[model samples]
Target: MDKDLEHRFITQLEKHQNIVHKVCRIYTSGQDEHNDLFQEITIQLWKAFPKFRGESKFSTWMYRVALNTAITLYRKSKKSVRGDHYEHVLNNLKYNEYNDEEEQQLKLMYDAIKQLSDVEKALIFLYLEDRSYKEISETLGITEVNARVKMNRIKSKLRTILNP
Candidate 1:
């Protein structure tokens, strides 16, 4: 890549790196795996950057690439230790309780989300990010209707796990 292009890519990536980190947290367990996935996503982003047409928001494009790389390249290991960083961040949520009741509830919700399949996780991640159905459809290569249906199912599944 040319210096100008490389500089631009780095600047844009630095601005949106939090998107990468969030995807890593959702997709990987264990610190080592999270780091590995983050690097892999960055590499994928750099490779794909040359082709980015600026037709969408950079963060939206970044999410598509990052989510695809994570889904394809970073299969969670069976022996993987769940990442603690998620809980650390959740611990700081405004609603966190001194008695830790909210913390416990969040832990249960996170565990339930953890049990979701990779594709479902991607869907929920996009949903939680407040991506429009059209954007989720574009990112996931599904129809808007399918995205909605799948989101409904994912919500039902999570509700079952969290409530049961």
Candidate 2:
């Protein structure tokens, strides 16, 4: 990459690293898997960097690549992974930054999201991140109507999971 583009990529990555972290958290239940997914996302984002035109916000494009990388990486690695360590990590994570109720709710929310299909999880992640239907539709190559419908379904599923 050229100097200007390399600088821009680093700047964008710093700004949007949280998106990759969040996706990795949702897609990979274990620390090792999460780190692997993060690396995969970084690599994919670098590869796709040149194709990023100024048409959409950089974060929006990053979300697409991050989600795609998370799903693909998870699928490719799922068979070899075991989940015995996940509960231990979950227990170790300190949520004292938030109130007890809020922390519990956040954990429950992700637990529910973990059960979703890859497509549903991607839709929910983007929706929760507050992306517009148009941006999501463009990123996912779906119609705006479909994006809206998928988000509605994801919400309903979450409601069922949380309420049940």
Candidate 3:
């Protein structure tokens, strides 16, 4: 990449890197895995940057690329996430008060999410990030109706997991 392009990419990437971090955290179990996935997503983003025409918002495009990388490209050997690690994650959450009930519920939710399929996880992540159904559909290459249906199903599944 040319210096100008590299500089622009780096600047934009720095501004929107939180998208990558959120995706990594949702997909990976531990800090080490999160770091590895972050690196892989960064590399993929760099490789795909040249092809990124500014048709949509940069963050939207980044979400598509990062989700695709997490779902298809990144190989996750570890499956189960420890509940204690979720306590660590919960500390960083923006909640004003942290009760053990809330923490346990969030941990259960996270554990349940870990059991979901990659596409389902992506849907939940996008929904949690406040992405609209249209944006979720675009990002996942699914129809808007499909995104809504999938999201509803995912929510139901999470509820079942949490209650059961």
Number of the top-ranking candidate, with TM-score as the measure:
3
lDDT of 1 by residue, 1-164 (tens): 27677667777877788788778777765667777676677777777888999999999999999998887775644233244533432232232112324335456666788899999999998998899999999999999999999999999999999888
TM-score of each: 0.79, 0.79, 0.79
Lowest-sum lDDT 10-residue window in model 3: 90-99
Clashes of 3: 0
Give the candidate order by descending lDDT.
1, 3, 2
Which residue pairs overlap in candidate 2's backbone?
Answer: none
> Taking the tens digit of each residue's C-alpha lDDT, what string does model 2 give over 66-124?
88877776677643333343433223333222123433557878899999999998888
Instruction: Go through the candidates in order and give the clash count of each.
Output: 0, 0, 0
Q: For model 3, how does the per-residue alpha-carbon lDDT over 45-140 read when each residue is reduced to its tens digit?
A: 777888999999999999999998887654555333234523432333332221235335466667888889899999998898899999999989
Candidate 2 wrong stretches, greater than 4 Å: 78-105
Worst window of 10 by summed lDDT in candidate 2: 90-99
Which regions of candidate 1 deviate over 4 angstroms? 76-106
Tell me model 1's lDDT, rounded to 2 decimals. 0.76
